[model samples]
Target: MEQERLVLEVDVRVAQPRAPRRGGVELDPIDRDLEYTGSLLTLLDPLGLLGGVTVVALSLTHGAFFLALKTTGTIREDARRLGTTLGAVTAVLAVVTLGWLGLLTGSAWSWATTVVAAVALLAAVAANARGREGWAFTGTAVTAAATVATYFLALFPDVMPTTLDGGRSLTIANASSSPMTLQIMTWAAAVFTPIVLLYTGYTYYAFRRRIGTQHIPEPVAVG
Candidate 1:
């Protein structure tokens, strides 16, 4: 009876769940919650507005040039029409984005400005479709420049509040990385950016003329 009791006790102890081991420190649930909240805040941050503006501008310029090339030949009439349609759509999007920014800033003339910009974009697309590269480039350039300017204007006001608090200041200041990181980034830019720019320029120069059926290489026959 004593031996059976001892075996039972050992089995019970072996089956028991172990407690979690303690670390040096444990985060409070509130702190963990706040960390998650901070991550969400960063994802929705408006401080990276300039990055968005740069993407839009670069997209506009590259899209216009590529469309112009694709639409230059009579054999691809549908392609030309599609290009024009895409251009018009992008232009309208640009106008809407501009108006959205203006509205956020409490501009009374937002609607009017948006309408005018949209109309100008439509006209520009039509002109570009009719082989007016200059008009198309001008419209794209204007829209891109305006978008960039508006982004900066909106961003500055948001960052510059009347009263400054430690939390607010920290949020704004820590939004960007350290100065040494930025300096290294600048050094990388100096090293690689010009090379990329030169190669891009060379590609543009090499394919400057309008593409035609001749440019499409003949397909090889499979044995």
Candidate 2:
């Protein structure tokens, strides 16, 4: 009888639900939270790409204007040729970098892209150092445009992918924010964007003149 009773007690104890342990560290919860945060952070990169693209476009347009202002009726044909060649080379390098990033995700591609971009960038630096101002400016403009395009192309899928699941995912995540918060952010941007544009325009206009040995003022005497 005691043996049967002991067996019954063991069975009852085995069938009872016990409270989960508190301290051993579960991986699933941590992994899930990390994944959620990572997705949120990924959205920022696309916005950053868009911002960079806008800046590059502005710089290129302003730079062309600056060049025209500085060299009006004075630029040699050779300088124009050099500038065009430099721009073309830099643009090609930029396109290669963009394609490399989009198609290749491995270490070899990464290294190759880095080496090519570095070479092109170094060439531009050397040209500028040699007083090839037009070439330098053209290279800068092309490089910036390429970089912006590459980043945008990579990040666009994260922000707004073609896949239905991706769109739904972003929608859910984005909609989690409060309506009042969204409204405030929208209003703030509306108020500040024009101010930013005006300030940027003013800065470009103020610095439009070219730096030349003759134009540089002598250092003021100091006590």
> Best candidate, lDDT-wise?
1
Q: Count the backbone clashes (under 3 Å) in each candidate.
A: 0, 0
lDDT of 1 by residue, 1-223 (tens): 9999999999997885322111211111112112221223333334235336535644655365455654456644654565576675576456545655565552434444445555656666777688676676566556555555555555453342222112232134644679999899999999999999999999978876667777789999999
Question: Against the unseen true structure, what C-alpha lDDT does each candidate score?
Answer: 0.54, 0.48
lDDT of 2 by residue, 84-196 (tens): 45444544544554544555322443444444444555555456546565556555655555455455445443332222222232333543469888899999999999999
Clashes in predicted model 2: 0
lDDT value, residue 106 of candidate 2: 24
Candidate 2 residue pairs in backbone clash? none
Largest TM-score belongs to which candidate? 1
lDDT of 1 at 183: 94
Supply candidate 2's per-residue lDDT for 189: 100
Superposed by TM-score, candidate 2 places the C-alpha of residue 139 at a distance from the truth, in angstroms, of 8.3
With candidate 1 superimposed using the best TM-score fit, by how many Å does residue 64's alpha carbon deviate from the native? Answer: 5.9
